[model samples]
Target chain A: MSISCDWPQAIIGVLLSQNVDLVAHVPDAGHAALIRLAEGHDQIDVVTLTSEEEGVGLLCGAWAGGRNGVLLMQSSGVGNCINALALPEICRIPFLTIVSMRGEWEEFVPWQIPMGLATPKVFEAMHVEVFRATEEQHVAETVDAAGDFAFTTRRSAAVLLSQQMLGAKQFKEG
Target chain B: MLERRTLVDRLLRHRPDNALTVSSLGSPTWDIASTGDNPLHFGFIGAMGQAAPFALGLAMAEPNKRVVLFAGDGELLMSLGILATIANKAPANLAIVSLDNESYGETGGQSTATAGPTDLEAVAKACGFSQTCTATSEEALDAVCDQVWTAKGPAFINLKIVCGPSPLVFPHSFDGATAMNRFRDAINKLGQTQGSYGRSNESEI
Candidate 1:
């Protein structure tokens, strides 16, 4: 089944093919479709988290348990996961986080701007490679290659889905 | 309140072979090492608010093995939301035992949230755990001890421990890479032998 969110569909397809079994996520409008697909999939187990940081630890645990996992959250959640990324960095625990972008050039919400802009730099500081997909067609391939390198090389990577691909969130003044 | 180190030693003394242990950094980690290092223990170098979630992940991944977390009350407070997360995931092979000294032992026994009105056991219960408990004395801990090892979990036990300094027993190594390698290999190679991990091919770091 297909939805208007084709990027989410493609991303889920890549994750499924990569044998990713556990998906830890905090709810975000951009990830709604992908989260739904992950929940319905038989091979993937969805874990709802109260915050994004927990996903980092949870994914490492999955590795220790002999399983592969992924984390889904928005750019704002990136700030929450900074310190937690230390685990993957020092331990060489391979993991992936698919981030939905917000606070771009045309963003209506000013609050999202700081984190969205700083996302890549923050990840780089922790030695986590950052990959961006500003176009829908490139989303699947980017995530697939990134995911492969991350799990195989035992390194952490973050795939940033740009706000352009997600369209603009309009702010209305009443 | 029950003494923290003594409680940890007691629990490890009767630890099940099919169980894997995850301890938070600092005092709890020291307490675990004090008992004696085991290949199965995953001691954290510095992921402060992550012990319980890590345990949950391991428990879900290794359904055949029980996973327990030994964390400090202050550490758990840093990520209180994890309680709700763990309860929702509801990994039957998981249990969390917070050494509730109501103080941060590493930071000079400063008072913590649990020292005030916060109750971790109640929080766990409210978060939808199958079993939740609080033990103020050794007798109480002894009675509910089996619940941690062989009960229908995810269980949460708040051990109200005395606020004081105890001797630190550091792990052989605090490197996250070494710990992860040992832990991952143990789970993979140890699955068939009732989860009791034997010597691994990798040299211990």
Candidate 2:
């Protein structure tokens, strides 16, 4: 059950803006589109991490090697990364994180809501800048902007792409 | 084993200006004692494993500057895989110093991998770090400092520091907002001054 959407294009734009040579991720239902896009790309090195925080380290390493990279994870995973995010914040490393938000808009599970509600507040408390991706049309531009912010600010920035933006179909088949 | 304070003092004297320092959420108050106006970045957020990688980013972003990671044994164990990556992509300017207290001192001294007779120096050696030192006394630490700092690749120093209070009040429990803002401002200021790229004004998701 594939849905016709420009999500792939937005992800590609993010990859381009970040100069993302390495992709580290912990798989989730909502990121299927972006993960698929990463898999198909030959220029990027996609590594599946054991945990969300490990992705932070992977991105940091890639960034050190003069490669742009992104960490793709779910909102709940952000909770797991509060300490991890500090790595970029303190080191002044521009880190781009693409997070799939849960517990908002059309959330079906109860577990995701706690972290969903806490994700933004947690990021805010951690001093990490966050942006939300609510619509399909805005995904590319938002991701590009986030990449710019991360690079320019030399800090961690996130794009909280809503579940609706990815659409239920993206997850239904997964 | 070296007393925690002695290790902190040595680091303070040796750490160069513009060096980036990252500390874990445990004892060994090196950040509190050593960090001055210089660009010192410490992690006081969620108690998890993150210091080494963050230092990796700083080392990458500012290759000319030295990057130091002051991690706890517990925290280092949380993401030991980072060592593999660090070894594979050797960063000459990066130094990882793990304070081995043999417990999760932050969470009420809970037992972790270090609680047993585990040796972190061996672990780091197995992970391919060319330079690995286990310092149980001030003399040992001082003797190893030169080797750890002068190594061409990634270096690991396992300091057997005694456990004590974390020294940092939990920033997240209160005044979290204020602390976050301060950190944000500091980061932005550094970026504006040192980063080659400029920041965008638009907010993104």
Candidate 3:
């Protein structure tokens, strides 16, 4: 049985505290709670995307307009963003993406493995700094640090919350 | 067939003073640059299929101000699903204008999905645009531009254009950071003048 965690609340608190005005995401179970927290918040505007890459454009526009935004997606979604990420990378728009990782350590899904294993290296090749958090206690602080580093340096950064931290996606019988 | 440059020029002339314009890469950016390099007009140096999503963000950020995305049909097709995302958010101040020249002009006149059977206007409607229409002639283009600027929208317009011998008018810089900062500066100035919504320079410092 999975007990609820406080990290989602802590992460949301830090994002709001950092003055992030927009939260753009594609639906992923790993980020569902945090997404709900942001959607319920009055200060932040949430833009749900059909695909992950759209978040890149959304955040670039936020940066252009002098607002900050975060992209929340799963590890597989990072591959969808390779080309679109160039918008912020080339433009030097400050960006933060908190990625909920899949396909490592007791993972049930096979298709997710390739991209999941490749996410950090892919982001690094695109010039986005990558940070990983495997422990629940490190979640909020890592997010805060990622936001600070990305925004202050005017660079794109990602914090990958590993499967161990997110807990395994439960397999259920139909 | 509608001429893209003339249509973009017409669109700009009728666009509101506070409306922020985001142009996609390639001919759309050049066409916007040809009009003038206003700080309010952000030209994508290289990002394709991003103008609409970018504009969507800007529209949400500046709810009081209007935001328009100008892109080629080919470019818009690359990220066709953004239309649904835009509809889901449904920012009242946002509008999208697709110049359907039927070919990717930047890539040497290769035909695109629009050239075959893809109807972006219909797709936008299916995605739930509050107002959606198309323009195949100059008169229709003028009429659509009117609705594009003045109407209550998350509007979508497919302005069909004749791909051609048009000269490219390059934007002064390919630097994305420069473009981003310039746009922010312009918005800040506007906010300060209007006494609303602008970030203070001190916080940035």
Candidate 4:
């Protein structure tokens, strides 16, 4: 059973503490609450992207322009951003992304499985540090640690919201 | 069609001190680099279709400075919807120039959609660009310069050019971290000098 709630509020607090002003995403139900919180914040400028890869470039641009940013996406969007990850990897720009998981616990869709399982390995292949948030208390601290580690080291980092914590998406059974 | 290197050199010669530049991968990157490099120029070494979105973000971040992207037709096609994304955001400081050579000039010149039925300028206009032009000649290019740089944007320029064999021109440095720092430092300095880092239009930094 999943007990993690208030993860969205906790994540937003982490972003604010790190002074992240730009937030980009391709809308996903997993991230809906967190996205709204960012949008509601006066200091955070929200960018809705056509694809996930665009967020990678946009955040790097914000960083180059002397601002901090975050990208929120789902596990499937990870496949769309593999090559674009080269920007941060090759350029060594500090990057942070929060990925909400799919295809775990009680997955209703089979298509989300491959990418969901491959997500961490894909990020690791690109040398981006990966951290997982499996418990309510760990979500904010995981993000805080990843953000600090990425910015301080000028390296890329990602925080994965586990299916158990996020509560697997429920679809009606016929 | 215009010669790309000649056209880039000419346009960049007039690039104001307050402007920022982003270049897409391959020929467009080489074209911008051939004109001579600057710390303000953030040329892409490998992010193929990302130049436009990156430039948009920069423009949004530093609305006081003009941020222009020089991209290739083939690369732009990979993410044409980014034009719509930029249009929606409607950053006044952003401009995108597609160096339309009608092919992937670096990869032995294979044809792109622009060679067939694609009209990028029309695409931009359809995507909500208020100022757009397809410059087929030097005269046409010259006519659009002022608006491309100074108009209420976001603007799009589709510059038609023949795919000529140009040498690989690298940016000032290949070090990503170093390049990023140089760009960040420059942006910070501009914000300080202009007193517009977190001006009224932008959220407080």
Best DockQ among the predictions, by candidate number: 3
What is the DockQ score of candidate 1, to 2 decimals?
0.47
Error of 4 at B44 (Å): 1.0
Give candidate 1 misplaced runs (Cα > 4 Å): A1-5, A170-174, B192-205
Task: Give the candidates in order of DockQ, highest first.
Answer: 3, 1, 4, 2
| Top-TM-score candidate index | 3
lDDT of 1 by residue, B1-205 (tens): 9988888888887889768999998988889889997888998858799887788888877777878999999889999899998888788878899899898889887899898999989989998999998899988978677877889899998899998888878996888898788878776766553322221111233
lDDT, candidates in the order shown: 0.85, 0.68, 0.85, 0.84
Q: Candidate 4 docking: what grade?
A: acceptable
Score residue B106 of candidate 1 by CA lDDT: 90
- lDDT tens per residue, model 4, A46-66: 999989999998887877776
lDDT (Cα, 0-100) at A147 in candidate 3: 89
lDDT assessment of candidate 3: 0.85
Among residues 3 or more apart in sequence or in different chains, the pairs in candidate 2 whose N, CA or C atoms overlap within 3 Å are: A131-B204, A131-B205, A132-B205, A159-B205, A160-B205, B1-B136, B2-B136
The runs of at least 3 residues in candidate 4 whose Cα sits more than 4 Å from the true structure, single-residue gaps closed, are A1-5, A172-174, B191-205
- As for candidate 4, its clashing pairs are none
lDDT measured at residue A105 in model 2 versus the true structure, 0 to 100: 74
- In the range B143-205, model 3's lDDT, one tens digit per residue, is 786568868889998888998867879886788777777788888777642312543111465
Tens-place lDDT digits, model 2, residues A1-174: 234557766678667666665677888878877788888888666666657887786566445434577888988899888776765665555778889887887777788789989999998998878888887777778888888878766678889988776644223553
The Cα error of candidate 1 at residue B106, in Å, is: 0.5
